[model samples]
Target: MSEVTTPAMRARPKRYLYIAVLIGLLSFLAYGATYPSMQAEAAPGTQASLEVDVDLTEWELNPSQFDFQQGDTVLFNITNSGRFSHNLEVSNTAQHLNSPTIGAGETTTLEVTLDNSGTYTIICAIPGHSDLGMTGELTVSGDNPAPAEGEFLGIPAMRLSPRNNTAVVGSSQEVRVTLHDFTLNADSIEGANVGGEGHWALFLDDELIASLGEPSYTLEGLSAGPHVIRAELRNNDGSAVEPALSSEATIQVPAAAP
Candidate 1:
């Protein structure tokens, strides 16, 4: 037997369907509100952008040399691992860029576009820093580029003991150096470049005799007569300090008895 059509029964089924649709719509809206849209990632074996890691330390930059392709965008991740403050500067004839000073144990980022092919100088803008070997080079493949000019720093105050015209009875003489705004690091000598820290170069009669790590040095094998002793501050790599800080002392030695 065929069932008779009833509008109320059919209408009830439609109402249930409507309620299900409404619940589904509400659930969709709630999920959308709770979560953010996902972003597309780069395909495998591909990168969205080129990145380079740079390390800054006592008077040096890790990966001191690197290269990039022309017209490519690069992101430099710079980290300061040294105790002193440092900054990075990238300059070429086509572009010049600088990063803010990064204190010890800090990190920063620099983004740049290499539209032109050439060599870029990377250095620490802090005075006397680059001179101490806090520098690097970036080569953008293509054409030759002009070399960047170097920066200079002022000299520190220095004083030498063993006053001029002082008489010495023995062949050995004691020399002392008093430096201001600088430190003597004998352990770091010939190790790595470090700012505001290095050893002193001792000169006798304008000749290099010794590299002194301590403040005082005893000179031996001195002949009887007027002799000149000089001391100059130098970097850990034995490079001459900027502005050439030095002090001299003249002393007289008596002749040996016959």
Candidate 2:
């Protein structure tokens, strides 16, 4: 009688082990409730006290123009204070070169969050000076994010290679900015719209530099003559709603080498 166990072979292996443990517990509780973690003593850079005085041999643009309003999480305490060598970048689209680098009295901070309204830019990709302008612009959202004829979210047109467009102010310039066509409805990329995509800014001439997620760069201790760089394609609440393809370039820094 010790051989009487048959309910269809124990309910078919307990119904295939309860459907493989309920599909691995709903894929580990949906990846632990959607990605979240950032605390290694927090503050990676971005606290804002306002002090952007980047002068790559007098290109001139102190307080050029920056407004920030949608939802502002502000903080751009970059300090290259001048003496050559510089970096800074922030982006939403124009293909990904999201900027960030500071050297020459070095100090960094750029925890931006803007929330979107429309109008975005920030330059310095290095190559021939962002096409000869070194760029700037960021406005975000608000261009009728919908309520009548829907469809809003665009800033994907990044395609640069040939050594990240070009830049040779002092030396070492291999910069890269690659990302493209990031269509969106908005949820993060500038909040509201509940989908995605937006952010761009890289300037080293006027010195904002890069926030690049991937565009490529190596720029090192600059100090030569004549410089300019640019990149702007934003919309993640920092704005620059595409200035008819906003961009700039102009390079000539090669000097320091005695």
Candidate 3:
């Protein structure tokens, strides 16, 4: 028993010290990586409504334009102190459009985010919208804000031109859109087979006019009025379904210019 040497007495103390040090290091890194973004994430969704006056003729906006890091959360407030039957739209330069009715005198807040690290365009879709200074953009970079998910829903991106928000009906208008690529595994998006592609259907708020399942598609012979176009997708199972990534485009198809 003399060889026992009581080595356990020395080893136990050192092991306990090492464990304590390791835990401290991990805790520090965890906090450091998440703190900044958690602070930047503006309250859950878009901002709340605002009170505006009806007598004013001009308006002001909090952020005419914005740029954010991947994990950053942006907060936006809309102020419309102008006299007109108008609203504000937000989008990226890549053609994401939004149109909110401010109704001569109203104010509100909205939000958009980039879960992907890329450049984007935001615009107001009211007729003659962007041209009337109703548009702005938000550029994002680095690791984006993804939806706590690890899957793709087979949905592709949709876009129109800067001047596409307003068009003249019964006129030869250029209808263009682009669909990007996405990857899906484990079939979490429904009827998803595997190695299937994505496509889009253009509508005039009533009828289906074109099917753009490729990179880009255009619709001709369009009549004028207020029109809203949507791009939906089909899964690997060849089912007409709404992908998690559907986008809507609005244009004022003015009563065929007389």
Clashing residue pair totals per candidate (backbone < 3 A):
0, 92, 12
lDDT, each prediction = 0.79, 0.51, 0.52
Residue-level lDDT of model 3, residues 33-150, one tens digit each, is: 9999999876864533333222213333334556666544444455566565444554432224344555555665555544456555554444454566654555666764333232
Candidate with more favorable, higher lDDT: 1 or 2: 1
* Candidate order by decreasing TM-score: 3, 1, 2
- By lDDT, is 2 or 3 better? 3
Say which candidate scores most in lDDT. 1
- 155-236, model 2: which lDDT tens digit per residue? 3355443222233634655545454544322234555422235555677677887544344556676666655666665666
Candidate 1 residues lying further than 4 Å off, grouped into runs, are 1-155
The C-alpha TM-scores of every prediction are: 0.40, 0.28, 0.44
Q: Cα RMSD (Å) per model?
A: 18.0, 20.2, 13.9
Across 10-75, the per-residue lDDT of candidate 1 in tens digits comes to: 799889999999999999998887665433544554424699989999989898998887666888
Better of 1 and 3 by TM-score: 3
TM-score: the better of candidates 2 and 3: 3
